[model samples]
Target: MDTPLKNLAIIGAGAMGSGIAALFASKGLNIVLIDPMEGALERALKTIDRQLNVYAPGGVQEAMQRIQVSPGLEAACNSDLVIEAVPENLELKRGIFAKLDSLCPARTLFATNTSGLSINAIASAVVRRDRFVGTHFFTPADVIPLVEVVRNDDTSEDTVARVMATLRFAGKRPVLVRQDIPGFIANRIQHALAREAISLLEKGVASAEDIDEVVKWSLGIRLALSGPLEQRDMNGIDVHYAIASYLYKDLENRTEPSELLKSKVESGQIGAKNGQGFYTWSPERRERVLREKSAALGELAAWLNGKAGGS
Candidate 1:
């Protein structure tokens, strides 16, 4: 099984791809960043360097040397680990995995930097489903501390443990999720909140600004400390359960599945991912969002470390 990463490959040099590449390279690991074109890889390198410059302690320049930008897939095949950060399309991701499956050695760990997808389906194109795991990193991966290590039903204990160890070795909070589900872990909660957030906006219940304020400073803040389940237990499940029961019949039940969301997919408006959502984005705006999030994550990581007091 793949152990703590000695060398890593990041496929699809876009925002997430570059961020993941910067993450490993910043931690002193050799990273090969590959893209279908030289321009994509070049843009990814610029973004990665900018992020590392912001949060990277030694400045981005020093760490750029460890990052090998490759326009060719052949160079990436040498990695001990390959993280596919391609587009969210299943076929595209699976196609990349199939090539990686054939390009790399049997022992190399295969990971998808996907937020919400079926690992089994992705790995179906490859022979080793056990080695295939979800290594979901945040947008600015170099700075985010949380890395959800999702293990599917077919996954072995050793595979899960080794991936967890690798992330931990890179100073991440590698949270193990035993089951594979759509939007696993944080993203599930995010989608739940987002779905409702969209509902509130469409239903004229509140303005977008007000809704964000209420959640960001209230439920969103509290959720940072503990999840909904733990928070309910802390407050009282009976009371929480009662609230959910009422919500299911009232405000929550009143919510219609977003036509905008559906049409967006049909029309291809995949948020900042595709440059449109509830908000619109440009290349400049995308980088701005990433930079802001990365800085926040770096601060959060530092605070978490201090809170743990070096354990």
Candidate 2:
């Protein structure tokens, strides 16, 4: 399939939307970022500018020039592809997809930036379900290299191929998720690890700090170089089997959210955005952590690129 991705309409100006716009714009794709809320477009532009300065200071202006913010969905009618990054509300997404289906051309591909939502249910709101697919980008989308390209039962092969190609062209490591299961692949694995972490905390197995340090220095580093399945093989499958046989029953198997997490949300200590969560976050500490994380991801990206080039 040829790359039919050029003009992109990003329909949301929140963090995820703006970050996505910056990522594509930096790769020379003209973007129309649409949001109806007052001052949203301006805030998104500022965010895009700030992020571009960090990622590509010399070419910030060039990238900014490629982004055109608008206050309505009509501005996206002429786009080749429309990526909806709206808040993760099923009704809101359905409404947006319904409108876009009526306004956009028949050839335009529709993709969602949902972290873990039903892609088929979202596509049901549109007539061209074959053209709709999930393009799940991680938080801080500009820095993350992984993009989960998800396809539902009705999604066409051509749509999957073209969407993957577009992501690759935009400098992303696209992984094909063959099914429309909730959480897809990455989030399933991620939340499993998170559940265990929280379980340990609740059981007084360790403090949050120690638990994070253990993962960050051990499984985290190893997983970065080799995935879980590969690492298991490297460690000897017999060892894994022996451990799982004894420990699987003891692991956190609750289907509901942990009480600790529920309480944190109920108290409005959501995370870095709210200045509190598992760790207390002062303004300075939050900024420092954000900077450190961005820098670390940048370094990892550079190392991965070098390795790929060498190979």
Write down the lDDT that model 2 would get.
0.91
The CA lDDT of each predicted structure is 0.80, 0.91
- How far in Å is the alpha carbon of 68 misplaced in model 1? 0.9
* Model 1 TM: 0.88
User: RMSD of model 1, in Å?
Assistant: 2.9
Encode model 1's per-residue lDDT on 1-311: one tens digit a residue. Answer: 43587888888888788877887787788898888875898788887777777877575776798888777678877787888898899999898888778888887888898888998888888888888899898856777678898876677787788788778878888888878888898987777778878878878888877999999999877766676778888999889888878677655433456775678778888778678766789989987886687688688768867875533
Q: Candidate 2 lDDT, tens digit per residue, 117-210?
A: 9999999999999999999999789898889999877899988888888888988889999899999999999999999999999999999999
Best by lDDT: 2
Error of 2 at 139 (Å): 1.5
